[model samples]
Target: MNITINRNSETPIYLQIAGTIKNMIEKNELVKGYKLPGERQLASELGVHRNTVVKAYGELVSEGLLTASRQAPKGYFVQSAVNSWNFNNRFFPLEKMIRYHYNEREKRFQEIFNDSVDKGYISFGGIVMDKKVNPAGDMGSIVKHMLQFDEDGEIMSFYHDDSERLKKNICHILAAENMYVNAKNVQIVAETNQALYYLMTLYLSEGDSVIVEEPIVPDNASIFRNGGLNMVTVPMEADGMDMDKLEMQIKKHKPKFIYTMPNFHNPTGAVMSLSKRERLLEIAQRYGVPIIEEDSQRDFRYTQERLPSLYSLDQYKSVVYVDSFTLTFPYGVKVGYVVGPYDLVDMLGRLITMTETFVSNMGAYMISEYIERGFFAEHTKRLAAYYSQKLDLLCSQLDQIEQKGITYQKPQGGILLWCTLDENINERKLFLAAKEKGVLMMPGFLFYPYGYQGRGHIRLCFSNVSDQEIVDGVRLLGEAIDQVKTKENCDE
Candidate 1:
């Protein structure tokens, strides 16, 4: 009932009224079944014509935000109480405070994951590093060494002014992968998540189009949507994104840039083949489109023949490389970097400074120390060996139930297994049954831009779970699939 009307605004009075009320209903300020003031009463209160209030009420009613009673004392009632507000359009003209928001699907998934964890579910849901392989002791030793040797307190205090040492170390790290770059081209961020988010917000405005893989990492999809970028998603094939579809989308949408995880892609774990890498780079450069290569999983290769990163193969300087130590090291080591053109990196640094002030100097120092002592190379080798075994076990166990309509390709590297259920299997029911069986995984639809055409897929992350847990978790998943099949049979 407390609606404010800005008389001077260009938006119509009726629209402003309707938008405000809709916001209230979505925010749950006006809970379900709350009665709205009658048109005449509200019109009088706001000093508007009764028809103006009627127009406002009509809009909300049409949108299903409110319901109109046909009774004599006709009043509008709130239809639903939404805890999470989902705005289909870019921004609310009335509410200038909410410039951007989180993806509602990602928000719900976080809730479900948290709830499952609280119930002690065996988690195949997160791409987290396994504790068995965590280099906490080694990292701790470095931390102690730095503390003991520090004369200026730079490591212990917030006295660092730049990311020079970390950038130089990252250059060396990339050099080992044959992707050479100078410190001037590197801009550090808290993590790859931040790197993507900052890049999208910095370079693109709201409603600008960008092309991405269909079943992208939910977190990255969330970032794109929340930034108001019109995501043109191309489906993933066994090798990589469907190149023909990618080209079509590129020409149609004319995206600001292309974002790819050409290494071991998240969720799918499909590495871009050598041919695809060259082709993608060629297509990107031909279109004068800059590609953001997110190589977070580049270091986790197991059985796959390593292909040169798109950044390394690019002769056109059309690729911006983004990577993180979070996946390679402990999650607490939130160090990530962007290697791009000098001006872009400089601008990214300025944006980081203006917004977050600075990246974690301690994390930077820790990574630099690890690289300097030659520990990083050894650690990655150890991870590859350890995780390869886990991946093998997961694939073998999955092979046991392959006849049951659960299908997947064995990824040569990376943390996750992208699975396709039989077309008839109810994905929602399967997810619930899995949770009921004390196992959790990500439904594939959550990874899609608008949950389009992903009902038959799910992603199981193997890097975090123990070998025994992986076995048990797969058993539970198989059982869940059986339950769904049984239920479907019963329904028939």
Candidate 2:
């Protein structure tokens, strides 16, 4: 097997390998039923990591060009006639497809999740609040009254009155976080991700740079990619993102803005320290760069005192705050808001009006009424207590299996737990095996911008699962992980 690899090329080595193999299969150089070199052997011959070869083979497998053998042969075998479709057809040609740079793997993950749901798999996958803790009984009454009696035409009218009321309610909520802002500085968007999309469209252009954490929120990563922005990622430390490296990257990239989840960050559950937040704001103010702060998971805290948000500490008004009611309320109510300078808020508000005509007006009115009636505070307080018990159950179950090369830090307050696996464990295999055993989980690689580097981690969201399901799911998860480890050891 003589394959040429250019070390200097911009294309990744795994991609280059997959491309070469794909070309060979298309030209019939490797026919159906042919067996390729094993991952370790190919990696040894090519002077690359075994994981790189694994990814190359996985790419072909995903394209239906290869199949794995369970008996006799132990490597991937070529499949029959996989690439029959034409890439340059007359109608709906591939060359003229939409410009959104969505990764095919994300679609694959969604397919897996849907299939798991249909199969009744115990779900530890989605970031949703438990239905048992939902305030539907209270919200139902508010929704019913709004629809029955359109008092002041708040629900039926296209006027901005309902929107204004929602912003005013959001301002009241932010006051608890120590962020003092009026309704004029608030803009209602559909959710946090949409808020980010709007801000990116308004501030950034093609090829403009932005800085974010290495293991960024997956949706935000997709948004940045689709918007044609250059992403500069800084590594995450236990306390938060490494400020020293962040400053260095800022000096180098001069990004349009910095995006951060300062409170209860997604995937990692790391809370940024007060000192780091102050330094971050100071640096951004000095450099004339704005910071986009996402605080979606702040209200789910189980322990520790709540710290002041960057929006509150910013004397120069350099932080644009974004949050949503997805977790605080039920999942379907996708109401979110952005707080910034009045000019920016006004522009975002106008954009929302132009694009959506109205941002969930009925839902907004319901939430505003909920806040005014003191239901919002009552619901959030109950949620913290409810989710605290769930988190404790998950941590205790995980504690029993710590010796199995899995470890995690108990988060001070968040809905998810971030666990680190032993270096030899493969998270993709673990996820597949767990799914096969009627449990679903997220692989850490999905959170990373580049694959293979995040093979040693996994995130489990315990918010939606029941206590019994948590116990059973952890048991199955541990078995699946052991099976993968045993197989890897045998192969070696």
Candidate 3:
């Protein structure tokens, strides 16, 4: 038996030996029932301690590659190669796996989001609005009222186009935001993201470039990536996506379409100003590029006047608008809709037909009845008030930590707050350390794509936690930051 060891290598001796032996087994040089040299004899030949060889043999034995037997000349021999085969035996390159190839950040993101909290751990991971503010009673009342008109499953008919009544109600909702569109141009989707995915599949072929604003919610870029499209990011300023830098990138890449969330933008909660919206439309129209506007959170605005949607401003029919009430009603209702030019809406209708997937007509009927009868407007008012109070309380709590070198913008309206820490504190280290103290907030790294790191920044969602939990969570978060800072000072 020939075995080589590199003393200068950082890999442990046992690992190196096990790896070499495993490779030999995979290449068939060491078939089943092949005998390994005696630990003492192998150590003598390799000029290493017998214990090192013992540990190596011990690892393989534990892995079921070898079994104790007197059948061999010594005592043990290879047993079953099939039993030793692992998940990596597939030999497929990781880059070819769509679920993980484009980004592993999403897996890490899921880990943080899905962590089961201890009895009292404060979790701020999900973006769902606080249930206390959700219009559960109103929805219950609506559902109870809708059941009266069921007429033996008549509303559940098979030969259906997107509900004409629901589509018109959505049109009226958009009209309130100054975006006037006919019901024929609206395609109801189970969720807003479904609209985005369908649009990406319709417009972007593999390797096509799509312009996106940076520091967005992960789903925004992830859907485009899954469609085999490349993303060109335009940095977001306080007002919105930087138009000057955007024009520069436009000149360079000339992407197929631009995607943005103008009102109460994700993670950052930065609302675009009216002027920025106008300029955004002008630039897209000038370049002959269409825009996909995710207008999901605009209804939750707390401070300023609502901005006109890009779809409303486009006379050239250059924008596709997506909206959902998933926040106001929470995840229970998946009602959302897409509005665009007649042709694009027709294409989406065809795609839905091909997939044989349609939005829940029952969910549509309930939401439509709620909105038409004016329950939704009143429900939103109540939600705005509830979330506004929480927002104020959270800002007050954050103010208490201003002296600790943690500062954040008090979002005008929306559930998330973007915070920046002192240059000395590492946000990544603070995230893990904070979890130990029973408080959770997302590290900003998950929001950015590969090759971009959101250092010294953390995003906290006020949408999900309670008033008391917010205080304790932020206080614990502050303590975590201080612990990091204090340790750094002592090390210095």
Candidate 4:
């Protein structure tokens, strides 16, 4: 066996060796059941450390590309009948890519705060509502009133395909946003996450392809990958997804659908321009691929006129629109709705039935009543204004840090700001250090399907943290980063 290692490459020596062997097996250059050189012999032949050889073999074993037999004096050999089962075929690569980005951080979350039940740490991590901004008093009264009404059998015990009242409320909400659609065209009552899952499962299948923005919401990536579809990521610029690359990918891949969060896009906080929106729809129409327009955070914009949703511009009914009040009203409500072609709605409704029996009828009723009474709108307006103030405060404090190595965009509307640290800093290491300091932030890599692509970036949520905590947390972060850099320089 022959193997080459690149010591100068960023890839570890063990990975280089393991990758070579895996490639050889994949190409049939090394046949099934072929014996690999003994670890000591291979280490000597390759002029590398023995532990490097052991690590390489361990990786192959985990990948199911090789098997070890201690009965035969501890030797490694390629698995017999390797082609009998395609290990890669069962693996969801895209989901793995997305999970790989966040698994470490999530594990760290469990490790650091797993014991603490209270919310004492400065949280720039989770997407949360400002308790002060939400009309919890009014919502509590509504819940109490609904519970009292349960005695009259008017509390919604069953699911209706089209909750007429909820549909009407959704239509009115859309109209306020400058998107006019009849209640008849809207499908009421499913959580936003479930709605997205229904759209993917109903519209796509194994081996099908979909186009999504790079550094997308990790959950969406996981959903698409787990559904056994290929997700091709289009890079984003300050304006939104790179239209040129998007069109190029559309042509190259001929994807079945394109998923986008046009307003205050997740992870990047870049809003799509109206012209770009028009262009995106035109391109989708040209390619004959349906667009899943996620307007989840459109209502959270802090500055500039809110752009019309893609569904607002969809004369051809090619856009499947999904939105929710989870970010604004109540996270526990789990109420979201989708508006699209009637047939598509019916299809998704059937999927909803098969999956969760039905969307929460009682929850739907409460939301509909809240909207009809105008509380939802007023509450959301106030919530947006409050978040805007917090956003301003957060950015102002971050600006005063005067750190030469830190860079971030001041988002106009969304709860999160994506930040890039000095190139020499590692966000994963910084995350660990920040955890020790009781400041929590989401590493930027979690927003993308590719790990390491966002190595120097981290996401901070302003909607949940207090004004004072934001100031103190940023200072602590600066100190932690400086310490990491100094240590890295010393080690080098």
Candidate 5:
């Protein structure tokens, strides 16, 4: 195959090579089963670094446009099936990549749990909060009251808009958190998942773009990618999303929205500083992009002072806020609310109606009663103190592990901590091996839009497991890491 390289062009050398190969495949110059020159030979022919050639090949493989196999020291070759390639017919490339690969990470975690169950090993995977932490008895009383006062057959009726009383209760709750929005400005009830889905569907479309934190909530990115929006990720520092990179991407891409978790961000519990929050709003206003502020974990702050939400700071009403009770109270209470400009809320409500026709009113009523009685606030405070101690205990144990091999950050709040293994370790394999030993954790890759980007990172949840289990789980996980490292070294 003949390929041209343009070192003088602004395009990166590897991308140029990948583009040339892609063009050749499209033009039928590189026929199915065609053999390409070896990496060193390609490097020589193109007058580029060998790593550049290798990177080009890796990109091609990732795009599913090329296949590689080993045949007794054989080199790479074009898949004979390339004749069927149809770029035009392709589902958006990034979306396909995310769906095919991201689910694999989830599957690996699930497999670990299954293996642990079979072997009677105590598994510490999944975001299962402590049962004792849940105010199930209180919630049960609320449910009983709901059934007794079930009037006008509203309880049995399928209604989309939450009961007006519940909306008022939610509004009051937000006000206490420094987010002063009117009940009329908020849409009362959808599952938190659905709330996000409605917002994305209302604002984004095929060929549109969105900016996200690099290692964001995995499912959020997967949904965005699958929706056919190009997702550009900006790396997150301890302070928050790197505002400089965010500004550059916003200027370059002019994305339709920016999805962020400002409070106790998922996977990594880095909280956005107040100054960054103000600047972030300024950038969003300048770029004319709406900010989706997920304050799901607001009630879990371990510190003495509360952080102000973006919605509270938005003088221009450019922030679209979503909050949920799933993590705080009972998981089965599927109630979440979104607050934004009245116009945007109206549009989103219409979208929600079109999809879910409204949220469950009974669930809304029960949650409202829970809040009305002030049980929600008290319970959350208790949970925060409890989890704070657990986090401290877990981090102490994790710190004793050989630090030369592993890295982790202590999260101020939330249930998860992000840990990175040595470059030599493969988290995906470690996740599988850990499961076999009755331990399960979300691999770091599951938090990114591109699953492969976070290859050496894993997320551990300390909220669900007991103090003893935290110690045991970390010990088993440390052992699993050693085994995976040995296996990877042997393969190399």
Candidate 6:
């Protein structure tokens, strides 16, 4: 996004703009079909007339360097086709041409960011739970026990539907939360992300509208978008999503569903009040719109009193509850489940048959055994104690630093702490300086679906690091903040 212009240059401003953009395209800085900045934005950024930037874009169009796709708002897309008018060259199978494109872009970005990850860095950027409390040895013991006891034929055959043992165990555990559900409503999936994607496929079509709470999980946002759904966002407040605004938007858009996380909202760590949860369910029932409640973090409470989930509060059966073990268990296990009305669950089961037949049965077996023996409860109890201390230590260290303008809430439950700084502070600048100091944090915008609207917010996860690491990381984060602010003053 960095574009520089020399106002005193003898060359025309429009040509300079065109030349710079063309060079970026030629250098592969802008990938194929990359959306170019709007003309007004580019012009205002460079302190030039709008028409000059428009003329630059026109120049590119004349040279066949850019092409407009049917997707509007992104006026010009950088094209690989030079003579796009050529019949044979332009004709492409719709399915195959776009195949693997988004994945490639994702891989490209992954590589770009992986360079910042260092062996010694104190990283608070990721949501993955710490492996120290991961119960690997306990899980291994359970798997060995399963191998000794489970009949080989049962292991080989996909005999029973949807891991009945695991579902039964899940139901038993969830009864404490008042989520009384039979096994028929549960279907195991590989992961929560996959579950959300499948549900998106079942519920949404191209250009269908979906109501989302602003600053949601980015992967969820991406899944909704890739499924060809238009996102309408409602503001999220400290208590929960703004209900009045949600009702207004729901009436306006009549979205396929109201997607939300009522407990420990990602990157925010705010819990929805009981009254608000009831109100949300009432609104959904009134609108006849199903709610997709990602309740993964409901079990991760550290200190705060647990709130009843949207699913538990819903008397109308309008909430589609999704959760996964990845946040609490090992990543490779990748096991999750979805619970809803019988018809919806049955449809989801059939959809899984069409795509991924079943999740790792061996992993599911281990989880089931772990839960059956009461080890899962033990593990979570220990995790809650471990993370509660870590969260307190992190917040305490930040407070001790006397770092002015940094404000955060010590979360009642969940892995992350959302810190908001004064509007004068730049999260991006702070991120770079923190990275340089071997401390990594997730920039706030990664939680949002729209543009870079998360300026002063940053998310720091406490579940993945040791106590010493948290202390050191928070101290270094304060240093990085001071460093960023000092640099900002110098620049001014």
- Over the stretch 173-199, how does candidate 2's per-residue lDDT look in tens digits? 888877789999998888899898888
Which residue ranges in model 6 land beyond 4 Å of their true spot?
1-118, 136-140, 148-162, 452-455, 486-492
Each model's lDDT? 0.77, 0.78, 0.74, 0.73, 0.72, 0.73
- The positional error of residue 40 in candidate 5, measured at the CA in angstroms, is 4.0
Instruction: Write model 3 residue lDDT over 1-492, tens digit each, in one string.
Output: 756664422245676677677556645679888888888888888777888888888878886777766563666687654432111111111121133244666666666766623335687765755556666446666666555445665544322333788999888887878878899899888888888888877766676678998886776677877777778788788999999878766765667788998887887888888899999888877776778999887777786576677777788778888988788766477888899878888988888888888677777777777787787888888877878888889889989988887888777888778887765666667888898998777877677774332235778877767778988988998898888763232211
Query: Mind giving the per-residue lDDT tens digits that candidate 6 earns over 230-313?
Result: 787877889999998787666656577788988888868888888899899888777677889988877778654777888888
Model 6 clashes, total count: 0
* Runs with alpha carbons beyond 4 Å of true place in candidate 4: 1-118, 149-162, 402-404, 452-455, 486-492
The residue pairs found clashing in candidate 1 are none
Clash pairs (backbone) in predicted model 4: 302-413
Best by TM-score: 2
Superposition error at 276 for model 6 (Å): 0.9
TM-score, model 5 to reference: 0.76
- Candidate 5, 214-297: lDDT as tens digits: 787656766776777788888888978999778766765667788898878887788999899999998887767778898888
Model 5 per-residue lDDT at 477: 86
lDDT of 6 at 302: 69
Select the stronger candidate by TM-score from 1 and 5: 5
**Per-residue alpha-carbon lDDT of candidate 1 for residues 85-117, written as tens digits (9 for 90 to 100):** 221212111111115566656875676656544
* Candidate 3, residue 171: how far the Cα is off, in Å: 1.2
Prediction 3 TM-score vs. true: 0.75
Compared with the true structure, the alpha-carbon lDDT of candidate 3 equals 0.74
Off by over 4 Å in 3: 1-102, 116-120, 136-141, 148-162, 453-455, 486-492
lDDT tens digits, residues 141-165, model 4?
6666656446666664443333777
**Best of the two (5, 6) by lDDT:** 6
